[model samples]
Target: MSVSEIEKYGKINNMYKVFLDIDESSESNVKPMLTNIASKWLELPNGFLASNTMDGDEIYIPNLHMINLVIGN
Candidate 1:
């Protein structure tokens, strides 16, 4: 499905906080795509963090190899 459609109809609930997560390696060159995806999924003007860490000490560990998106309403 298109990004816009996915975002518009994606489910959101207490069990999910995000509908999609696109991981681009620290050296990948897909800023445009990432931006497009992020813009489409995150409709609210809020803060977001995209980071990678070897040590798992935060709520999000993008570098630990865990990949999934939480969708909540």
Candidate 2:
């Protein structure tokens, strides 16, 4: 599904919005990855909500390359 489709789903379900911070060169895998995530959301222990840090505290470490799934209403 397209990003707008995902956004519309989120709006209807009050679920989430996906934000990608990836370079153009890495665009090839974006759609499949998003589809996988959307399909697996309910299987996640924490459901749709998430955070960048485990304890809700900022990580002071610099230059960290991480993929965070933060679902917001």
TM-score of each: 0.18, 0.26
State the lDDT of candidate 1 residue by residue for 7-58, as single tens digits.
3224633222224433435324343434533332222233333323324323
Please give the TM-score that candidate 2 achieves against the real structure.
Answer: 0.26
Model 1 clash pairs are: 12-72, 12-73, 13-72, 13-73, 16-71, 16-72, 17-70, 17-72, 18-70, 18-71
Candidate number achieving the greatest TM-score relative to the actual structure: 2
For model 2, how does the per-residue alpha-carbon lDDT over 1-73 read when each residue is reduced to its tens digit?
2343234335445444445455566666654564443322222442232223444433233432222443332
Total clashing pairs in model 2: 0
The candidate that wins on lDDT is 2
> Could you list the CA RMSD of all candidates, in the order they appear?
12.8, 10.8
Q: Report the CA-based lDDT of candidate 2 relative to the real structure.
A: 0.39
Tell me the spans in candidate 2 whose CA falls farther than 4 Å from its real position.
1-19, 40-73
List the lowest-lDDT window of 10 residues for candidate 1.
59-68
- Tell me the lDDT of model 1 at 8: 29
Cα RMSD of predicted structure 1: 12.8
